[model samples]
Target: MTRLSAAFALALALALAACGGQPASEQGHADEHAAAGDHAEEAGGHSEEERHADGGGEHTDEQPSTTIPADVAERAGIEVQPVGPGTIADEHEVQGLLTPIEGRVAQVTARFPGPIHALRANVGDTVRAGQPLATIESNLSLSNYTVSSPIDGVVTARNASLGGLADEGAPLFEIADLSRLWVDLHIFGADAQHIRAGVPVTVTRMSDGKTVETVLERVLPGMATASQSTVARATIDNADGLWRPGSAVKARITVEQQPVELMVPLSALQTMNGEEVVFVRVGEAYQAQPVEVGQRDGQRVEILSGLNEGDQVVVEESYLIKADIEKEGASHEH
Candidate 1:
C-alpha cells in the first residue's frame, strides 16, 4: 500500500475509536447520576421515618407544661402541696347577732320612796354587788338610807339626780353582766328543719372574720317577729370583752359531716383551655391536669379523679403557671 493511504486509514480508525469511547463515557456518567438519585431517595425516606419516630412529626395536642426555675417559682409566690383525704362540712350559713344572756341584767330602783340626798355612782361606772349607789333620807323613816347596786356589772344607765324625789320601783340604774353572751342566729325555710339543739355552730364576726365554735343551746319555739325566721341560740364566752352586742355576725350550722377520699384547696383550681385544671409539679416542669370535682366546702373541694395520692399540686398562685403556658403557646403561634 502507498504511505499516504496507510496514514489515512490509521487516522480514520483512531477517529472511529474515539467516537465509540465518548458514548461509553457518557453512559457511565448517566449510571453514576442514577445511582446518586437512588441513594438520595433512600436517605430522604429514612430521614422522614426518623422524624416520625422521634416525635417531631405533625402531631398536635401535646400535654401543656411550663418549665420554671426553682428561684423563679419562689419569686412568683407559687406554692405546692400534696393532695390527700379531708372532711367536707355540710354546713348551713345564717346571720346572727351577739346578745347579753337573759337573767343577767338587773334594773336598780329605790326600795322605798324618799328624797335623794347624794348620788355616788354614774353611768359606765363598774360596781360590785351591794355597793352603795345613792344615799337618801326616807320620808317614812325621816333618816338617811343608802340605795345600793343589786348586781356586779357596769352601770348601763343612771336616771336619778341629787336632791330629786326618789320614786318607788322606778329604774334608777341598769346593770348588766357581759362576761358571757348568746349568739342569736336566724335560720329560715328548710334550713331550720335541719338545725336542732346539740348541733355544732360556728359564729363569725362580720367585721373581722373571727370565728368561734359552739353548740346550739336551743331553738326558740316561736319565730322572730321581725324576720319570721326560726331563732336558734348558742352560748359563747366573752372573757376578753371583745364581742359586742348589736354587731352583725355570720354563723355556720353544721348539719352533717361527709368524709371524702381526696381533697384540695379551692385556691388550687385554675381555668385552662376552658376546663378546670390544677398545676401538678414534676421536676422543674409544671403540667396542667384536668380534674373531676364533687362535694365542696368554703375552703376545700373534693377531687374525684385525675389525681393520685401524694401528687404535688399547686395550692397558691397557680394562675401564674397557667399564664406562663398560655404565653408560650401564643409565641409559638406567632
Candidate 2:
C-alpha cells in the first residue's frame, strides 16, 4: 500500500512539470509576434515620413526654369514704342576726307628769283589775304626785299626758310581756307545711281562725335581704278574750325524718300533666321514677329511689312527676350 502511494505522488509531480513547460512556450511565441507587429508599424511610419519630405510630388529629371535677373533688367534701361506708318527716306553711305572748298587754297610764290630773308608764317598759322608770310630779298634787278600773302587761309605748307633761296613760281607757302571743307566719298557702283549733286548729306566724325550737315557738291566724272567706285564730293561749313582738313569722315546721303511706310526704332529689330524680326509685347511676354525692312534712319528703321501701325514693341533689352526664346527652344529640342 505504501509503494502505491509513492508512485501516485511521482505521477502528480510529472503532471505539474508538463503544465508549467506548456505555458512558458506559449508566452514566448506571443512575445515574438508582438515584436514583429511593432517592427512593421515602425517601417510604415518611416515610409510616410519620406513621402511628406518630398512634398508629395514625383521628382523629374528636367532642367529648372530660369528668368532674367530683376536688377539687370532695371539697369538695362529697356524702353518700348509703337510702329507707325510714315515717310521713309533711303540713305547712301560713303567714306571721305576733309578738304578746302574749290579755289580756296593758294600757293605763295616769289614774283622773281630771290633769297628768303625771314619767314613770318609757319605751317598751321592762320593768315588773312595779302598778309605777309615771308620777306624775300630779290636776286633780280629790283634788289629789294618784299613781303606778301596771296589768300586768306591757314598756312598748310611752307617751303621758304630764313637764308633760303627762292625761284620764280617756287612754292613759299600753301594756304587753304578751312571755313568750308569737302568730303570726297567713294560710292559703290550699284549705289552710284542714286547719288546726285545737291543731295543732302550728313557727315559724322567718328573720332570726335561731331556731325555736320551738308549737300553733295559734285560727283567726279569717273570711278576709281582700284576700287571701281565713283567719287562724290560733299561740302560742309566749318566756321568753328572743328572740321580739320585731311581728317577722316563718314557721309550719309539721302537718296530717296517714300511718302509713307511703317517705321520702328532700329533697336527694336533683331536678326533671326537671316531675317529681321521685332519683339512685340504680348501680356507679360514678347513674341518675335518676322518683318520686312526698308531704309533706316539714324535711330529708326522702316518696316515694309509683317507689322501694322501702333504695334507696341520692345525698343531695348529685346536681345534678352530673344535669348530666352532660344533657350526654351533648345530645351524642347533636347
Candidate 3:
C-alpha cells in the first residue's frame, strides 16, 4: 500500500509541473509581443518627425530672389529710376475729343448770292491756302468767281454738290489744319471747379494707344447741352499726324499738384502681404522692399519711406522677376 501511495504522489507532482510550464511559455510570448509593439511605436514616431520636417521646409523654401540677364533686362524694359523730387497729384480720367486747334478752322463761303457752277474740292482733299475749292456765278453780275480755301488743310466738310445754288455767306467747304490739335475734355459738377488751366494732361489715343503730354488750356463757360458738362481744352501737337480731329481719346487730368521731395514711378509699386512694396535693384538681383506711399500723380507716387534719394527702383516689368522666384520655390518644394 505504501509503494502505491508514493507512486501516485509522484505522478500528481509531474502533472502540476507540466501545467506550470505552459504559463511560463505564455508569459514569454506576451513579453515578445509587448516588445514588438514598442518597436512599432518608435518607428511611427520617426515617420511623424520626418513629415513635420517636410512641412516646415515648404515655408522656408520660398525666398524672393531672381537673376536676370542683361539682354533680357533690356528686352523687358527693366530700367531703374532713382528716387527724386517730382510733381504729384490726384488725377482723374475723362473722355475727350481731338479737334482742330482754335482759330485753325476755315470755311469757304460764297461772297454774294449765286448759283454754284462747279465743285473743285471734295472732302478729304488736301488743299493749300487760297486754293480754289468751288466756282459760282454771281446773281448780280452774272459772273463766276472761284471760291478758295483760306488755309492749308484737308477738306473736312462740304455743304454743296455740283451745280448746287448757294446763298451769300453759305459755306461751300470747310478746312482745318490738323498739325495742331486740341483735346476737348468734359468736366462735371465739382470736378469743373477743381480742374483749372495749367494742370498737366495726358491724352491717350483710342485708335492706336499712343500717348501725348499737354496741359489744360482753358475751362469754357457753361455746360454743353449734349455732354451735360463744361468743356476743358488742352493743346496737343499733332505734327506726326497721329492725332486726328473728331477721334475719341481718354485724358488724365491732374486736378491738384504738389511737389514731393522723394517720388518713385507708380509702376514700381507692387502689393505684397497687404503692404505696398517696391523692388530695389541690388547688383544683378531685385529685392522687394516695403514702402509707405503718399500723394500720387498720373505716373509717379510720393515715397514717404523705405527708399533713399538715390536708391534704384525697378520701374517696369517687375512682375516677371516675382514670378521667377515663386516658380523656383515651387519646383524646389516639389
Best by TM-score: 1
When 1 and 2 are scored with lDDT, the better candidate is: 1
TM-score of 3: 0.67
Candidate 2 minimal-lDDT segment of 10 residues: 57-66
> Considering only N, C-alpha and C atoms within 3 Å, which residue pairs clash in candidate 3?
none
Give one digit per residue, the lDDT tens place, for model 1 in 1-334. Answer: 4444543443343344334433465457548857876787687743433443555311112457765656556655678999999898888889998888889889988878899999889887889999999988878888988888888877878999988988888888888787788999999988888688998988999999999999999999899999999999999988777788778999989887898999999999988878888888986678888888999988889999878888999998787778777866676577
Clashes of 1: 0
lDDT of 2 by residue, 28-75 (tens): 654775686578668773333344465532111121122232333344
All candidates' lDDT scores?
0.80, 0.72, 0.76
RMSD in Å for all candidates: 23.8, 26.6, 23.8
Local error of candidate 2 at residue 294 (angstroms): 6.0
Per-residue CA lDDT of candidate 3, range 1-334, in tens?
3434533443343334334432465456548757875786687743433544655431121225554545445555568878788888788889988878768888888998888888888888888998888889999999989899888988999999887789999887889889888888988788888788998898999988889898898999878898799999999888777678889999899777789999988888888667887887766567677778997866888988877888888887766655555554565577
Best by lDDT: 1
Which sequence of candidate numbers ranks them by lDDT, best first? Answer: 1, 3, 2
Model 1 segments more than 4 A misplaced: 1-62
The TM-score values for the models, in the order shown, are: 0.78, 0.67, 0.67
Q: Model 1 compared with the native: what TM-score? A: 0.78
